[model samples]
Target: MSRKIAWIAAGGLAATLTACPARTPSLPNTPAPIHVPPGCEKNQTGEYHHAENPAFLYFGEDDGGTLTLGVARAREGLEGPGDAGTTVNIVLQRTPDGFVGETRSTTFTPSGTACPVRFPTEATACDDKGLTLRSVAATSIDENCRPAPTGPNPQWKEQRLVRGAPDAGASDAG
Candidate 1:
């Protein structure tokens, strides 16, 4: 009887060991390398090209009531226009913060007139006529700025504009 009991205990122990799950080896912690897109490096002037995403233009009436336009990004390292092909007139102003203020106006050389403009941030408001502008409030500015690694020759893309409905289209008559 004692021998049978010992055999049963040994079988139970073996079964328990078999039921246990295998352990996986732990991997060492290592930081991943940062990815910088094409044509996003800094220029000779020490300004980096703005990244494409999270980057957007801002337009509104300035304090003097004149039309105001600017482009902003959430991250640093953006200096000049990366890929936005439109020729823009830019002005830099001093700000209390270390960063400088930038304003831009598109040169509609082809049409000889300023084309209606829109930015990612102002898309909703300008949806009506396909033309909208937004104010540069403290909150709006704060939400758009992001930190990024500075680089030279940062690449930029041109923003394409869609024309409004053609005037020639007429309503159908039954």
Candidate 2:
């Protein structure tokens, strides 16, 4: 019957569509393994200082070689974020079971807010300057160039206070 033939054709098309290979092609739902930039030394324990700006943005392996990322702003130049300071920490612990990425943002002043937004990521985080920190590769290059190879995020005005090549120190070592 023509009805039977139509059903057979529909079934074949459905099977072919499900087997298509273009489902998803992207990085895993989490950040890649942390890679410490060259020329920077990891502290005996805790995060390594990758860049400095009165405060420090630290990233590297800790005492047990556990990869971690953190930012610290403190009074009296305290060494660790737990001191009289606050911090934002992102730790990636790999295990046989799975990968665990724990991120915590410390607020200097309690806003007494009743919460509005639910989910927030690094890209949504803003600093005291009200500017978001852009992502730079381990080599300090703007690999993705979200803003531009030489441009910063929120690309409205030119406001890169520290201007230089990412690997300026490595190149100047000679």
Could you say which candidate leads in TM-score? 2
lDDT of each residue in 27-135, candidate 1, tens digit only: 8986554222221111112212222222333323333212233333322354665434554423322122211233233433233544422222211122222222222
Query: lDDT of model 2 at residue 80?
Result: 59
Per-model TM-score, in order, reads 0.24, 0.27
lDDT of 2 at 49: 30
The lDDT leader among the candidates is 2
Worst 10 residues of 1 by lDDT: 39-48
Error of 2 at 152 (Å): 17
Candidate 2 segments whose C-alpha is farther than 4 A from its true place: 1-47, 50-54, 57-65, 74-85, 95-102, 107-111, 114-174
Worst 10 residues of 2 by lDDT: 156-165
Candidate 2, residues 1-174: lDDT per residue as tens digits? 999999999999999998887756676587555433221123323333323443343443445434355544333434554333444565543433222344454322133322211112222221222222233222112323222255333322111112221332322111
Root mean square deviation (Cα) for candidate 2:
15.4
Candidate 2: clashing pairs of residues: none
lDDT (C-alpha, whole model) for all candidates: 0.32, 0.36
